[model samples]
Target: MVASLSGWLQLRHTSRQLHSRLAPFSTSHASPSPSSSSLPQSTPSPSQSQEKERGAFSKLLLFLPGAITFGLGTWQLFRRQEKIEMLDYRRQRLEMEPVTCTRNNMASSESLEFRRIVCEGDFDEKKSVFVGPRSRSISGVTENGYYVITPLIPRETAPDGVQTPVLVNRGWVPRGWRDKVVSGEEDLDKPSTSSVASNTGDEKTASWWNVWSKKPTSPKAKEIVVPPPVKVVGVIRGSEKPSMFVPPNDPDSGQWFFVDVPMIARACGLPENSIYAEEIEDEHTAGAKNPYPIPKDVNTLIRYSVMPQDHLNYTATWYTLSAAVTFMAVKRIKTKKVRL
Candidate 1:
C-alpha cells in the first residue's frame, strides 16, 4: 500500500511539472472568449466592408448634379411663363388703332410708345442727321445704309406760337460715299440741295440761314428739305441708345452706331429735351424721285414673332437630365447595397 501511494505521488508531481510548462504557453496565447466562440466565424468580404465605410460625403457627390439640374428646370418654367405674358402684351398693344398725339396729350406720350399716332408738322431738315451702319433685310435681300433723322416742328402750339420740335426718323438711304449709289436698279447721283425748289419765303429764309451757318459751302455738305408742311403719321418711340457691345458714336466724324436721340439732338443743335418719333411712310417713293422715304416703323411680326418659346423644351430637357442622373445614382446605390 505505501509503494502504491509513493507511485501515485510521483506520477502527480510529473503531471504538475508538465502542466506548469504548458500553462505559461496558455497564458501567453489566451483562448477565445465564450461569446466569440458561441458565434459562427465568418471571413468579412472586402466589398461589404467598403460599403459600410461609405459616408454622407459619397452620397452627396452622387446627388449634387441631380439637385442642380432640378433647380434649373424649375427656373426655366418661370422664365417660360414670363416670356409668354410679355409676348401676349406686346401683340395686343401693336394691333390697336392710331391715336392723335397733341401737346395736350403729350403728358401720356411715354405710354404711347410703339403706338401709331398722327401729327401735323413741318420738318426742319437743316437739323437732319444721318445715323449709319444701319442694315435692313427686305424680301431676303440685305440693304446696308444710313437712316435720316429730321426734327419736326408741330404747327399747333401752346397758346404761344412757339413749339417744341420732335425728332423724326425719316427712313433709310443707301450709303452715299462708300459704294455706287443704287436704288432699285437705278444708278443715282448724290442728292443735291441746289436743285430743291424753294416756293415759300420760310424756305428762302432757311436757305439764307444754311448759307450763313456753312459760311463756305462744301461740295460734300448736302441738305435735303421737304417741300410741304403736312400731316405726318408715325409711331412714338424711345431712345435707342447703343448697347455696351456696340461701338460709341463719333459725332464729330459723323460715324453713328445707334439712334441715340439725345446725342443726335445735341449734334443737330436741336433742343436737348426733344422727344422722338418714327414716320410711317413718305408721300413719295424714295430713290431718284425722292431721296428721303418716310421712316417705316418696325414691322410687328418681325419684332415679336421671332422670340424663342422653347422654354418648355428646355425645362423638359433639364428635368430629363435630372431624372437620368437620379436613376443612375439610385441604381449604383442599389448595386452597392446588393454587393454588401
Candidate 2:
C-alpha cells in the first residue's frame, strides 16, 4: 500500500512540472496581444521616408498621364471612325447627285451631281479666262500654281439666251508669270528681257496659261463650229474667289494669271454675269488638235465628285480628338483613388 501511494504521488508531481513548462508557449499561441496580432511595423528614417514619398509622386505623375492618354486615345479611335464613316456616306451621296447651283438649294438635283448631265457647248477661246492662281497640297508641299478659267459658250442658245458654258479652271501655273513683260499682246518664247516678240496666230496655245499650253490644248469639240455643240462630262462644284485687279494692257511675266470673270468681264468689256464649270472629260471634235486627247479625271481623289478630301480628313481628326478628351475625363472619374 505504501509503494502504491508513493508511485501515484510521483506521477502527479511529473504532470504538474510538465504543465508549468508548457504554460508560456500555450498562452502565446492561444491569446496573442493586440500589437502582436498585427504585422510588424517598419519605420523608415526621415531621409528615406522623404525619398520614398518623392518616388511615389514621380510614379503617380508618370502613370496618371499615360492612363489619361490611353483612355483618351481609345475614346478618339471610336469617335474618329464614326465621323469618318458619316463623311464617307455623305461623300458618296454627293457624288451620285448632279451639279446644280441654285440660291440656297441644299439637295437640289444640280447640287451634288458629279456627272450624268451632258453640257452641250463649245470652248469660247475668245472669252477663255485664266482664273485665280493658288496652291494645292501635294505630298507635304504647298505647290505654287494657278488654274485657267474659260467659259464655254452654249451651242444651243439657252431659253434665257445665257451662254452657260461654265468657267473652266485649265490647270496650275508656276509663279514665274507675274510681270507685264512676260504677258504681252504676244510673246511665244520663254519669258525674256531681250527676245523677239513674235505674235503667234494662236491664243489658247499662246504664251499665256503656260501649264495648259504645256500639254496640247484640249480641242474645241465641234465637227463644224455650228450644230453638234461640244460636250463636257464632269462634276459641278463651287468657285473660289474673284480677281479685283484691273486687266493690265499686258501683265508682266511675274503678273498673276487669273481671269476672274467679274474682274475679267470688266476687262473684256462684257457683263459680269457668268457661270463656271471644270471639264474632266471632253468629247472628240473635228476642229480639235490631236482629235482624241486623253482625258484627266480627278475623280480618283478620295473626296472626288463632292467635298475635298483634305478638309474631310481634318474634320475627322478634330472629332477624334474631342471624343478622346471626353473619354479621358470619364475614365479619370472612374479610376480616381483617395489617399488614406
Candidate 3:
C-alpha cells in the first residue's frame, strides 16, 4: 500500500510539471506577437490599386483603336459606293452626243466638263506650251512624254466682235520633240516654196512633192506657217489643282509641270477665262509619226481616275485589324476580371 501511494504521488508530480511547461506556450499563442501586430494586413497598397485602375483604363483605351478602325472601314465602304455612283454618272455623260461650244454657251464650262464638243478654230502654234514629264502606256509599253497645249482662235466672234481663243491640249508628244519645237529646230528643216497654180501642175505630182523637192531655205525663212482654220472635235477638261508634292510651274523659264488653266492661259497670252479642251482622234485616223502626240480614247478619259478596288482593299484590311484588336481587348479584359 505504501509503494502504490508513492507511485501515485510521482505520477501526479509529473503531470503538474508537464502542465507548467505547456502553460507559457498556450499564453504565447493566445496573444499576438508585437512584430505581427505592428505589420500591415494583406490589403492592396496605393501603387497596386493604381496599377489595377490603370490596367482597366488601358483595356478601355485598347477599344478606342478598334472602334476607330471599324468606323474607318465603314467609311471606306461608303466611299466605295460613292465612287461607283460617280463612275456610273460619268459613263452616262460620255455617251451623250457632241455639243457645239460657243463663248455664250461655254460660260459654265464646269457643267460641261468631260463632254465632247466641236470648235471651229485656227491653232496658234507659236504660243504652244509643253507640260511634262508625264507618262502613258502605249500597247502595254509605258512611255515618258509631254502634253502639247496650243491656243485655238475660234471662228465664232464674241458679241463685241472679238475673236476669243481657247486652250487645246492637242495630245502627248515625245520627250525629244519638246526641245525641237521649243528651239524652232523643227522649222529649220522645211524648204522654201512658191505658190503654183493647180491647173499648171502635173496631175500626178502632189503639191507637197514640189515643196519638199526645193532646196532648204535660209534660217530667216524658217518661220512657222500658220495652219488653215478647221473644225476641232474634243473633250472639255477642267484645270488641275496641284498637290503639295508637285513642283510649282516656272513660267519665266517656260517649264510647265501641270496644267493650271489660268496660269497656262496667261503664259500663252490667252484670256483668263479661255476654255481648256483635249483633242480626240477620229477612230479611222492613221497613227501619227513618233507614235504620238496621240490622244487618249474617249472611254479611257471618262473612266475612274481612282479605282474603287483600292478602297475595297482598305476596308477589308481595316475591318480585319479592328476585329483582331477588339478580340484581344475583350480577352484581356476577361482575364483581368478573373484575376481580380
On lDDT, the leading prediction is 3
lDDT of 3 by residue, 1-340 (tens): 9999999999999999999999999998899889888988997889999987997788789799899999999999999899999888877877799877766777888899888887766667778889989888879999888998888776553332214577888788877777787777873111233453344445334446646665553444323444445556788888887789999999999999999998999998877878898888874224434455677677777566567898899999999999999999899888978997
lDDT of 2 at 331: 60
**Measured by TM-score, how close is model 1 to the native structure?**
0.63
After superposition, the stretches of candidate 2 with alpha carbons farther than 4 Å from their true spots are 1-60, 64-72, 75-110, 113-116, 122-145, 153-165, 171-228, 239-276, 282-298, 303-340
- Per-model TM values vs. the true structure: 0.63, 0.38, 0.73
Candidate 1: give the clashing pairs.
none
Residues forming the 10-long window of minimal summed lDDT in candidate 3 = 187-196
- In the range 239-293, model 1's lDDT, one tens digit per residue, is 7756689998898877778888778889877766566778765343333355445
Question: How does model 2 fare in lDDT?
Answer: 0.49
List residue ranges in candidate 3 displaced over 4 A. 1-29, 32-43, 61-69, 156-163, 187-228, 283-291, 324-340
Ranking by TM-score: 3, 1, 2
